[model samples]
Target: MDMRAPEQKYDPYRNYTRQQWSKLRDDMPMALNADEIAALRSMHDRLDLREVEEIYLPLSRLLSMYVGAHQRLYIAQRKFLHIEDRKMPYIIGVAGSVAVGKSTTARVLQALLARWSPKPKVDLVTTDGFLFPNAVLERNGIMQKKGFPESYDLPLLLQFLSDIKAGRTNVRAPVYSHLTYDIVPDRFVEIDQPDILIVEGVNVLQAGRLPRDGKAVPVVSDFFDFSVYIDADEPVLREWYVKRFLALRDTAFHDPRSYFNRYALLSDEEATATALAIWERTNLANLEDNILPTRPRATLILKKGADHVIENVALRRL
Candidate 1:
């Protein structure tokens, strides 16, 4: 099946078919092996060696070049100002709909970037850690809107990025647990000065809302040097979401401590129905309202096919 996006006149992005994108890899060596791929692949996500070689390798090569260029620019600007060139992290935002394989994309990029020459320390952080605690959500009566933009601590997230971008060392971010489906109290992840920081989330690219006085608020994407959006047909994403929900029933959902333990006893049919309802009511609405609208803001977009293969890549022209 042809999975290419329909051609549009006056489009800003320069599109490439998968085969064309694979050619850009040229002499770049593959940094990942079969075992590593298996470890990086998220539950219910398909990411084989062939997909990595054809899609991620070229993408990683491109990112490495961007990082190098940014570093040189930093030095040049510092020299012009006659100041010390204090190195700052190159922040990359990975944004996409739920079940769109964005988490796997972030992990793969982190692994690949860490292996590159000069071996800059690369760190990965998700915006999940910035979500409001369960108690706050419940108090606000927005627990049902958990993934919505309002469910996050926007000011805190903005401050975290600001501190990192200001070259602050030893920044700490809250830790979140998917098993318990809530923020872990008193637990934090320390991010030392890293060469690259990958911030992945469903709302990373979302623009902040205007205030009552019409003053502009800073957005998380404003701090991102480069951003990526993972794209797939809606039906494909829904199918993956349902499959992942079912898979978790046998895995994480079976744990008595899991927030979703109630789903563990559901029959396959019942689970599918429940998953579809949740997706339609929550995830799909979030995608349409908050995520998909940010596609044009990305530096690059990875368009996946029904089989979870990236079939096209759209890179914004400089």
Candidate 2:
């Protein structure tokens, strides 16, 4: 068996190794301290100050530049059209497979961007809130496909984004609880005219499956000023997912309020078996069928190594 990794192919993106990408920071002082990085790190996520300095700091800086450019363009366009500057928030979409650390990326960017010059208000919203309610999923018989594209309230999500793009303030989004594993009834998150909004989810970049009639519909990525896709080897992602499941079982799953409380008393072997089964049956299938296919649509791709460290960055060429 010739067990070598497949040969790399030429791509539209300009690839930069980690070392090369880090240099782009160029004496820019690190915006975040160790404590902040620690706070931003999600459960079972392997993030540290070094990774922040090398990877996220540069990314934050790049995003800041993009935001600035976008603002200037917005102003120019408004002036050309003889209209007032409504100042829509810059939208950034972060997408990746389960347990790929995209939540950490979104949190880090939100924190770092808020600290930058002009210090724009930043908001982070996950598409989990846009998921169809449990009752709806049950009725549709897709309870097992919770993270798949069809499981989301796509129209509502699109409307929210449209309002944000139109500079509407106090837009309300539904709230979802991970502990309950469902959307909380009558609970909402209000986004009040943030300067930047980061939308994170497994399917943020996914395009809707086209119908036979060739009618066009706006997808989530259509609202993004910039998009990032976290990339990793499938085996590494599977390992991380399993590890996260185990960690949650020891912590959140023990709470009586948790939907997964039933798994809290499972033996380690049983827990591992359960986690593996869930991942293989749902998450892996979602990744292969939906998430991975949208990778090319991102403006930036942060490619992670087996160690959960971002080893390279591929930036889409202008």
Candidate 3:
């Protein structure tokens, strides 16, 4: 008998494919019943039951397990330290391209997670809340780079998450205004101790690589209990961005209070062209340079098909 070395199999961080995902659906929890499904149905007109069942069902199930495990670990650590009763929020980071529907996913997860027995109240906070105000972006000459990591107040964001994860009470985050395209003055959202906090944004998983005299700063994913990256082909994302821009231009941009009021009058073709230009200049650039590279860092990866439905899910196995 010939003796040979055992071959090392590839260990992909994204471990699940479409077929394996179907198999996992049998064991995942069902948090949303018919009526709740009906409500979310109308809200997310783009998705249907099958997509939710196969994709989000498994994803939420994974998150629930993560939440439970984190709680157990917290308790165990505290007990070992001889501390009294305590709790910490399990932080989830959701990252994706601008119009890839990560915000909708975060909202849906928040609603579903809150319905769990003993109902752990889930708080959804977008990194948009940490975006520098328009005046500051303008001063820094980065108004066009709004979704880039540099556009946000990184220290403030890190401190806010540090507070939440450290179990701080009455922690408040600045509110952002889509209509005005800036951080609202004085307005804020106070997040008390919660079972889970989902933070969604474009560059949440991006590592800060600024040459700090000579070393790299800590990456954002360092704090995430679980992270998800929403993904789709570049062309599909471009089409969605253009479509969303046209829809928003026809609806929201026409309002007198709208910061994009000037774009309201663009003809369909012109609007599409402008949207493509913006994508080419800003969003696509950010996706290529910052967002896409961080995909491997996520614990879960939701891969959307050309039709904009989640066709596959990839889980990073333990």
Candidate 4:
């Protein structure tokens, strides 16, 4: 006697398949070439013009629309309040698991957005720089938890984001070196009010526990005007990570200054095992506990197929 249909769950996003999403490109120019894309891609990532045309062009076009709208709203607010303030850079946060090609996506967007008709100044920043220095991690006895939220200087990062959002000029962020696998001492990169800033990292979208006292503690995503989360299956992520680790043995690991120089001595079998162990211990744990949980918080989700091509896009409903 019950004729009611099953209860439907609410979904916040408007999902689009590959063909559907690509149609959103809507004549966005091909601003990057094959050679340019190659240079933009990370060593272990695959990104070609087709991917840019099919996936990234649509994304860049969508962001352009959002940027234009925000600019107009800023002007309208100033007029109504009868006060003048310098425009702040639109901050975009890109988050994903390691080896899922988040860097390539960020870089590609930077390239395309810079080519906007007026050529807005765009800067790319990675949260890797805000990670705790190795010595501090060692002192804190959390070296093994290096990529976890606890391993970051959350207060320092928040301060930096605050300055950027307040239209502060010449904001300094610490420099991190992959070769040394640590934060570079006394070195910093100054961000000078770019028209837009792209902050990319594995943990940019992380949200820590809230206070019960009703005090506000802003997380990293608070600074973002729009955010993206890159996603792939867990097994695929592990496979890509292992492959990249194996490939690095012939590359970065061969450098005497490389922190992973010792890995060059590992045979294929040994390196694979080592990569698997690291994935199980650090990266996988961080992804599951911290990163993946924040996926729903993104403005858009770029889901990838096993071959690393973006197969679907989910844009949050307004």
- Please, what is the whole-model Cα lDDT of each candidate in the order they appear? 0.93, 0.92, 0.83, 0.93
Candidate 2, 245-298: lDDT as tens digits = 999999999999999999999988999999999999999999999999999999
The runs of at least 3 residues in candidate 3 whose Cα sits more than 4 Å from the true structure, single-residue gaps closed, are 1-9, 27-29, 33-45, 210-216
Question: 1-318, model 1: which lDDT tens digit per residue?
Answer: 556667634677999999999999877898889999999999888899999899888988998889889989999999999998468899999999999999999999998889898788999999999999999999999988888899999989998998888888899999999999999999999898888999999999987667899777799999999999999989999999999999999889999999999999999999999999999999999999889999999999999999989999999999
Number of the top candidate by TM-score?
Answer: 4
Candidate 1 stretches with Cα past 4 Å from truth are 1-8, 210-216
2 or 3, greater by lDDT: 2
How far off is residue 231 in model 4, in Å?
Answer: 0.1
Scored against the true structure, residue 21 in model 1 reaches a CA lDDT of: 99
**Could you tell me which residue pairs clash in candidate 1?**
none
Candidate 3 local Cα displacement, residue 162, angstroms: 0.8
Tell me the RMSD of model 1 versus the true structure.
Answer: 3.7
Cα misplacement distance, residue 220 of candidate 2 (Å): 0.5
Stretch of 10 with least lDDT, candidate 1: 1-10
lDDT of 3 at 227: 90
Backbone atom clashes (below 3 Å) for every candidate = 0, 0, 0, 0
Ranking by TM-score: 4, 1, 2, 3
Error of 3 at 256 (Å): 1.1
Model 3 error, position 21 (Å) = 1.2
lDDT by residue (41-160, candidate 4, tens digit) is: 998888888899989999999999999999999999999999888898899999999899888989998999999999999999999999999999999999988888999999999999
